[model samples]
Target chain A: MRTWTWLHKWSSLVCTLFMLLLCLTGLPLIFHHEIGELLGTEAHAPEMAADAPRVSLDRVMEVARARHPGKGGMFASQERDDDRVWYVTLSDTPTSETDLKQVAVDARSGEILTEPQLDNGFMYIMFSLHVNLFAGLPGMLFLGFMGLLLLVSLVSGAVLYAPFMRKLEFGSVRRERSPRVKWLDLHNLLGIVTLVWFFVVGFTGVLNTGADLLVQHWQNNQLAQMVAPYRGQPPLTRLGSLEAAVSAARAARPDMAVSFVAFPGTSFSSPHHYGIFMHGDSALTSRLLVPVLVDATTAQVTDTRELPWYFSALLISRPLHFGDYGGRPMQIIWALLDVLTIIVLVSGLYLWLRKHRAGAAKEAA
Target chain B: MSARRPLPHHGGRAHRHGRAHRHRPLWRWPVRLGVVTLVGLLSALLADGFWDVVSWLALGALVAVCVFFGWLRRG
Candidate 1:
């Protein structure tokens, strides 16, 4: 126990400054969805024409192709329900070395709605820094290591809490006493109250860090089974109308909703399958459904089961990690919890510094 | 002055057995339990979608394991 207490104090002080910056940046990211909506930048998918024959996916592609003639590549189409905008083509041009363009097209009229942009500038940068420190793989790995240390610190602190609070009731800050004692009390109070929130966010973050690797593994393993039969067959032709494909997909799984569609030849979809993703009917599953791979040639529904366990877990962990799943009220609660964490961090630093000062004075005397 | 009794330590309770074997071995038990529980958590998360009942169960089990150790200690 004494060893754990020492470990807790030293580990926390080691990463205290970096984590403080991370927490400050992370707070705003928790509310990013709401803030994006407020800023009028949230994109949505246009509602399908009711009783009016739907527009053709080929037509949308044609319009997009005509508008941007120099680039002929079209990767995939993404539908955003809230903003009613369709992101049609992902393209690269010769003049720019690393610029990839995402063309947003109106689903109904197939007209190009507006210029392409990153999801959100400020929020994306902050999120990148918090999660990976913008250093790519090394940064992600380092942050994961830090998260492990955090878990250790959390456990040790809890062990020490009983000794500190054996007498006082929960929530006693002891503000009138010595500064170190006050900080310790505050730390215990805040830590216990927000334990659930922190653990969920932190541990899920570890899962999130492994997401890309999981996706690659899924593509190689489970997806291999779905594509093996069609290995030598000519690539399946992409159907002309996505709305028709969506309706066909819904007919197969009446209870499911169309989450997204992968164009044939795309990475997720098989060369012979049109991956039409659908989520569960429940509130929780609705946000992270597994894709249903539909054979584009025959319009036959092939794979309906969610991605293999690890991939699905990564998908589901994203919302809890981001604090975006629980609606506006939950976001507010998350923000409050984030502030409490900041206080714990600062107070912890204060206590360490005060102790260091006292030790120095004693040595001088 | 009247003879005074020692004030009780509010921290961990005094073990009846000698200090060497009195309470559960702190480092071995908690560290091992924490590691096992952490693995279970990662496995459950991988097996099911996040937010499933399995993840919640894993979390509850973790906290219970921690609290159980804390309860075993004196004060």
Candidate 2:
């Protein structure tokens, strides 16, 4: 409809500048995974020998706690493919409140390879800035508004497309005329080609930025119910064997591998819960986490098995927005699309200015 | 602002019949409203200290200029 076209154009014109900025910054982010790999941040956890006795999770927990004596117990543990258990914990420093620490342990021998520390690196700092501009909640909400504007702009630009392209064909670029005409044509061509990717990036970005809200909702709703029965139950004094708990959980699932475990008393795992996180074999399914809750004392499986569709959508949107899901080829394609979007935004502004100037000249004549 | 507005004219130099002459008046109010709205938004964005304040100000000025052009074309 003409009305929709007008809405799209005006919206695009208003937000294209900001959208261009996001695209430029987002280009670097798509390759963050590859960059991390190149920077040697990837480490192999020691593998357990087939004949070696399996180390107890309690032993690994002991090493992690000894490293930070006065600190609280582990918040969660991540078991990598190479047999490393990453103990993520919280401890108070002399001057500050509780802070996060991640300690890597050899699962085969329960040896602490390194002391617990913050893992803030170059890529992480950039990632934080890109996501929230270091302004935290407000910045994320602002970016969401900008993303909304971009969606509007895309629609408006497409609407103006038919009117502008009525005479010219889809790919036509009028380079022979004034600079404005040439730029406008390029804008249209580039916008059309990259429309689908732009939509994917925009829609996913909205959902991704809304993750905090989603978590809070889940916590207030289902998580509350999961924890309700455990109320007034004796707080877990000492937890059960995590390996046994993980084995029990995997036995119940029959298909997934243990990716992480939230210990009792943590947010994800209440006094009533032992959050045994699992992943599927395939890449797509692997990204979807199914947190199986096991009773800490009895190692009895709770009803919390798989995530609902909304949560699954949220989980998948992270990779979709980042362009790391498919592979390096997808990253390259995302980067190219980002660059094209920048061109479209710049050219669109130029076209609008040129039209304004032409209108002024005609008025003077 | 009142002195700047051109007197409305029904016919122009290029027109043989008066039918094509009348439609130009319909563009006047829409152009003026669009320009003013654009300026208001541009000013708010500049006040917020988001990037491209200068471009936004320039955009505001452009819309103001377009408002003038619209007034000029009323005749």
Candidate 3:
């Protein structure tokens, strides 16, 4: 019991502040799409006839590239609910992760809608703080370590709960008692209540932090094998038609819709192929992606395969962490739970401080 | 705020009432709530509509329990 108490105190102290920041930032991020629409930054394609002749993906790419004169296309994707607009991301180089810009193009009319800001906005700030604290990969790993601490704290806290609650009934907050006692009961109640939730979200968050590493592994293993034939070939100077490549991918996976296409030389694609990711229409499978590699020069489907277990786990972890899976009600519940979590963190900190102060007072006397 | 103050004793009070008021097993309620919470978290992710509703209710039960204990009920 003493060891558990020591572990719980130290672990919770280490990660409490970061966890608080994450909960606060994550609250707003739960409604990111809604907030974006309200801010008028989200581009919506004008309504067109159901059977309207859609413009080719090539035309969409052209229009997006035209907006950013010298930038190379990195990715093109559409939202799951709205296929009317294609958002094309362009960077200085195909593989550059920074200084990227997005241009939204109407899929039917091939008209540029808006250049959505990739950085510097309310949601972006929240996202940066929540995801990586604006410090990129190192920051992400740091938070992941904090998340690990949070798990340790939670487990130790649970073990300690058995001792604390051995006498008191469940959820018995003796409010008439001292503030510390009230908060201690509240903490134990809310902590145990939110235990499973915090664990799921926290565990998935840890998994998501390893996303970049997992993708690199996939690139080295599966992607390298898929494009082995073109290992020594020079990068394609001129690419084949984007429309043809997409069409071939669609033909290859007739049951799935294209989620996004990673252009050649991007981190998500090899130098010789267009990594067109596809998704199923179901609620569950939509979160799981299947990658189809098409030859960038020939517009031919080179290889299509299911992602490895780790990659699929990373992909699934995204929605679980984001709380975007079950629609508006789920998002609201997620926010409420986040508020409750904030309470837990604050109360825990208070309990620790009060204990420390009392211990000091005792020594002084 | 005396550092040596006796911890608030609820077990004696419950025992004075009757055997019925005796504390339940320590892990009983926590385990039940944990299972409900686990169901709530996964149901929505697996499917929608009825499952989502199930998830909302299951999770909402925890919130409801918190409200009942923290605010509604008094010792």
Candidate 4:
């Protein structure tokens, strides 16, 4: 019991401030899409006829390349729900994560709709802080460590729940008592109520922080073997028909549709293949993306492989962490839980401060 | 001043343990099931189309938990 209390106190105290930051930033991120639309920051394609002939994938890439000179095409993706607009991303090199650009093109006419500068703005700041504190990989790993501490705190707090609630009912909030006791009861009640949620989100968020490492490991192992045939071959300077590549991928996985085309020379693809990512239509299965590697020169489907179990776990973690899967209403629920978490954190900090002051007073006496 | 008796610290722990054991077993399964239900509901939220039912049911339970807490706050 003593050990549990000590663990809970120290763990919660250490991670509370960070957790509060996450919860607050996460609240706005939950509605990021909606908020983006509201702020007129998101691009909307001009409405074309229902049966309008969509431009070829080749034309879309041409428009993207023309707009961002010297930038190589990284990814071109169409919205799963909306079919009228195709979003194309370009970077300095195919592998560049930063120093990138996005262009929204009308699928029908191949006209450029909008090019949202993604590097700056309020949302980006929040996203950076919530993601890596703007320090990139090291920051992400640090936050992941904090998430582990948060998990430890949750477990310890739950362990102490029964003992603390021994004399009280499950939802008992003793308002007639002192402020400290009242807040303590509220803290315990809310903490226990959101126990499973905090655990799931925390665990998944931790997994997500290691995303780059997981992708790198896969690239070094299974991906290296799959793309070995292209070894010693010169990298393709001019890519073949993306339409054929997409068709080949669709034929490989007839049930799935292409989510994005990862161009050659990127981390997602080999030097000579277009890594066409295919996803299912359903919400749950959509996260489980399958990569179909097609030769950039021939547009022939070289190999298609389902991601490993860990990748699926990683995929599932994405939605579970964001709470963006169930639509707007689910985001609302996630936001509510986030607010509750903030309260729990604040009350925890308050409790610790009160105890510290009390200790100081006793020592002074 | 009256002579003070040294009360044993073990008494409080023992009494708390007894209380926990009595009600712990009773509420154990329900809490376990509730956690399962909550997890399922969260997973359901990620699902779309035909799988949305799971999300709705889970959301209903969570909202009820919130209302119950609200009522307590008011009381």
Each candidate's TM vs. the true structure?
A: 0.74, 0.71, 0.93, 0.91
Superposed Cα deviation of residue A117, candidate 4 (Å): 2.5
Ranking, DockQ, top scorer first = 3, 4, 1, 2
Worst-scoring 10-residue span by lDDT in model 2 chain A: A89-98
So what's the TM-score on candidate 2?
0.71
Better of 2 and 4 by lDDT: 4
Arranged by lDDT with the best first, the candidates are: 3, 4, 2, 1
| Candidate 1 interface CA RMSD, Å | 11.0
Highest lDDT against the true fold, candidate: 3
TM-score of chain A of 4: 0.97
Query: Residue A130 in model 3: shift from native, Å?
Result: 1.1
lDDT of each: 0.63, 0.64, 0.88, 0.81
Q: How is the predicted docking of candidate 1 categorized under the CAPRI scheme?
A: incorrect
Better of 2 and 4 by TM-score: 4
Deviation from native of the Cα of residue A178 in model 2, angstroms: 2.4
Pairs in clash, predicted candidate 2: A8-A156, A9-A156, A12-A153
Give the least accurate 10-residue stretch of model 2 chain B, judged by summed lDDT: B1-10
Q: Write the per-residue lDDT of candidate 2 for residues A127-190, one digit (tens) a residue.
A: 6666777677888888888888887777666546555654554455666677776677677666
Per-residue lDDT of model 4, residues A1-365, tens digit only:
78888999999988888898898888888988787888777778776678999888899889988998999889988776677888899999887878899999888999998886678887888898898999999999999999999999999888778677766766778887899988888888777777787788898999999999998988887788889988999767788998788888889899997788899998889989999988898776776789899999898999888788877789878877887677666778778777877888898899889989999999999
lDDT of 1 by residue, A1-365 (tens): 56877888887877777667777888888877566667655554456754544467667667776776765433544532332446655555222324455676766777776645554477778878887888887898788777766667776776676556555654566666776876777677666645555666777777777776777788788777777777888754435455566667888888876666666766677776777777765655665666777776667777677677677667777866765544454455556556767777787888788888999999999
Error of 3 at A286 (Å): 0.7
Q: Considering only N, C-alpha and C atoms within 3 Å, which residue pairs clash in candidate 3?
A: none
**What C-alpha lDDT, on a 0 to 100 scale, does residue A164 get in candidate 4?**
75
